[model samples]
Target: MSLSGETIRKIREAIKSAFPNRDELVMMLRMELDIPESEVPDGSNYNLVVFNLIDQLDRQNRIPELIKGALNERPGNPDVQKVAQEINAIYSNLSDKPLLKSFEFDVVTVNAQGWKISRKRCRAQYFTEDLGNGVTLEMVAIPGGTFMMGAPKNEKDSFDYERPQHEVTVQPFFMGRYPVTQAQWRAVAALPQVNKELKPNPSYFKGDDRPVEQISWYDALEFCARLNFTINVTTQRDYRLPSEAEWEYACRAGTTTPFYFGETITTDLANYRGNSTYGNAPQGEYREETTTVGRFPPNAFGLYDLHGNVWEWCADTWHKNYEGAPKDGSAWINDNDNPILRGGSWGNLPVLCRSAFRFYDSWAERDSHDDLIGFRVVCAFGRT
Candidate 1:
């Protein structure tokens, strides 16, 4: 990606203003590109080579203004012939509407070849629509942000595993509004699995709306991989389990309370242990099984069933505490054998549903016995 000619001109002016002398500006620009000064002039020197170098810099949009400023100022000892030649060479390289910045400031869509780029707003738009198989799935658009990932020591209703809250920054992404349901699972499993062992059980919960359970992490990964291929997205961040940090962050939205809805969870709010209550709430309904997604109001971020319905898998490897965890949203997958799990199960007490709750399970293992374990997937924004 390159900068426009007008932007290049402005950049040249800025550089000249800052450096004053052409020779000095040439040396500085060379230093910036990590190119040696000895390689210029006879071997691409300032008088002979700087214009093209500045052009390249402008194309990259890294320090265009800086280079432009240097070029605009005509040195008293003019090398007019060399300057004109260099300028002509560099000018040809400018694109019609070049993109200078390497890092994407805003979301953008590029062609499959990854050449053309277009600004993308509403990178993700969620919906709840029937899959035409008598099933409905809830989807959410998750904007990226930075937040404390793990539970703090003083975190109320937090488990020992969730201690020592750590900061985490996540890139924008999209997530399913709720756990995958039994109907969705069966539909996918019915397809011939390359590995027969990976096939889902027919006897598992079959409700079209109820969250799916008895699935292993490996199974979920395969589903996500298939989905990614099907969607044909350019993003390397595929649809997969949310990291442990991401789960809690999404669950809490922005609240410090035990649950996303605040301190209390009543029967009308979520599905959890009926006998147990949090935040002075009356007992809730102990459904003893997963409920339909979006049965309750969504959190501030418009995510449904983040606290209850089923225990959701996260990408992080299990750790005793948040000590020495990564500040980024990436899972701590180093030398660890167990992946983290978050959100309380349908059978869990309200306290377990707290956003800070955390648990561990073998990554290569399965949660076949637990009817309350399920998963949702995430994809980078604009992937769809």
Candidate 2:
């Protein structure tokens, strides 16, 4: 779970650039990693001190956590931000690609009866797409696996559309680490149009890091098309919305629970309306607006905003049920005008945010967009 040496070097450079003063760097590390002041390696040479601290954190498998914390703590520091993006891109272009690089994390599971927390580990390969202007998109590698795709008959508030609990075999692919952000949307929007024009700023909640909402399914497809045209010169993968089966497989992250974290969700874990309770979990804050991506914890596969933040657009057309659905994880398309949406939004009740829950845009209109909807992109596995 140790970060690659190149990643360490980039991080060190970013740290040095962001905090030139040795005392400031040490203090930032202490506060970010919760390391005691006395425990920081004592050295007059700043580089050695910083290297020692990074080495210790890497050995503890906290490098990902450290990078994320650093970025969140100093959102304005372009140097630190670039380092995070570069590190993710570095893994993809290495001469000797290490596809097995792994990480460890803790996941929570809750139910009407009670709650429990446990440590989980996963191996992932990821690459960052540089969208220009210091904006980047991190795409995590989801390994191929088999999983049941729908809710069981006895699950609480389960829907008929999510029925029969069929098994689906999904192929490995790369998924955006978080939903597409406003900065990323603007960058991609600026790219030469492939099919349709794009509005640079469509999100109601305005932040560079916040997920870009008010996007139609057609708009999402165009974003992927434009991105594919830009990135395919070097990497031949196609960028597109994930198939519904792949979305559920990745969201579940090897779990069968109603949600990735567990049987029920709490507002503490997502951005949905928290005034309403789910299972035994008590009612929590209802933010009523989108929050910054990565503000909440990720699932086991290192994906964020899978359960909430905003309902994500999926590739499949609307289907009444799992009956005759594609078992091979391809998009289920058949001339249906309505498109599917998953992973409920900030304004939705907790029940709608379950991993198995399903929603569709208005049947009459295919061009609809709103603040409650956004999407992440996926790249084919072998092409990269």
Candidate 3:
């Protein structure tokens, strides 16, 4: 009846404001909500009507197109902005994790990587999972496939460490739509500890939707453990830091470029020091601090902040090369336990964020939090 604390009502209001004279649209919308013509909508009841409509339309593949069209027509219009924000807000609040599966985008790869020929894509399928406590995580379901791991030998920025371009077959996995945010971090931190106790708020730059930083690899693991504990009780799925292979494969989506978006890296597409440029791109802004997640366009996988924003932690220990790495997507564990990190941070050079670029830190210093490092989680399906 409350419609998840009035959020549904806000979304409806936003939508109505965006399209003032669409009686035909309302007909479908009302039916989606299952609202009888005789029922008088009031207060929270307004949300019930809207939420019902959203669920029904989503299943019928009717909502995303309409929402996208309306928002895209006037993305900067105040009313349209409110509509997009409200919808995104609801997406972030649903407990089951509402995923907007769209096959409406195209795949791009570097000249070398594209030679192998990968699957075609239409839309970047995007989904979000609720973590309770009014917190949610957005994710993109990456279709499993085989791709060459590391950088190709002739890539403009290729490095020997990323060379020998080995083949890696990754299974389908749900990766966070964006890096973990302060709000999400606080929500999970409140959960009972799985290994080490987590500080409820452990970020350097404070913003609700900004990626949570200044956390160590151990902290990232603890978040995954506690998350899996709560999520698995019902879903029977495990949550953990993605293995290095999974991280790269997902970051690249189906692209073979220096960055998933294209051959060049720009601050406009990500949050990073803008004084430097890569490829033919020009230098841009230096925000000096992290920006809100999802501020930029998503890669083909419907993933945001993959190239920059924060250097994400990976499950594998630091490896000098992939000569003997696992071919089947499992993490390569090592005795030293030096943690592997990828996706470069807001303060890093553009080159560091390149898809094959790799770096590490003394994993023993799990508490050595830095503003440059953060992590995302992978929800392992059919895995308990």
Per lDDT, the best of the predicted structures is 2
Deviation of model 1 at 31, angstroms = 61
Q: Look at candidate 1 and tell me the lDDT of residue 19.
A: 55
Query: Candidate 1, residues 311-364: lDDT per residue as tens digits?
Result: 887777777777788777777776765666677777888777778877765533
Which candidate would rank higher by TM-score, 2 or 3?
A: 2
Q: Write the per-residue lDDT of candidate 2 for residues 1-384, one digit (tens) a residue.
A: 456677789888877777786677667767766767787777788888778878887788666556655654564577776765564454345343224334555555556543556545554567777666688878888889899999999888999999889989988888998999999999989765657999999988999999999998889998997675444423445689999999999999998888888878887689999998778888789998999998876888889999889989888888899899999999998797888899999999999999999888564135778899899999884533
The per-residue C-alpha lDDT of model 3 at residue 73 equals: 38
* Model 3 residue 67 distance off true place after TM-score fit, in angstroms: 39
lDDT of 1 at 177: 66
Lowest-sum lDDT 10-residue window in model 2: 91-100
lDDT, model 2: 0.80
Off by over 4 Å in 3: 1-122, 361-365, 382-384
Writing each residue's lDDT as its tens digit, candidate 3 over 256-357 gives: 778886776676577777787776677789889898998876777777888878989888887778878899998999886577888988888888889999
Query: Which runs of model 1 end up more than 4 angstroms from their true locations?
Result: 1-124, 127-138, 191-197, 200-203, 231-237, 361-369, 381-384
lDDT: the better of candidates 2 and 3:
2
Residue 2 local lDDT, model 2: 50
Local error of candidate 3 at residue 327 (angstroms): 1.0
TM-score of candidate 1 on Cα atoms, chains taken together: 0.61
Q: What is the TM-score of each candidate against the true structure?
A: 0.61, 0.72, 0.68
What lDDT would candidate 1 get against the real structure?
0.58
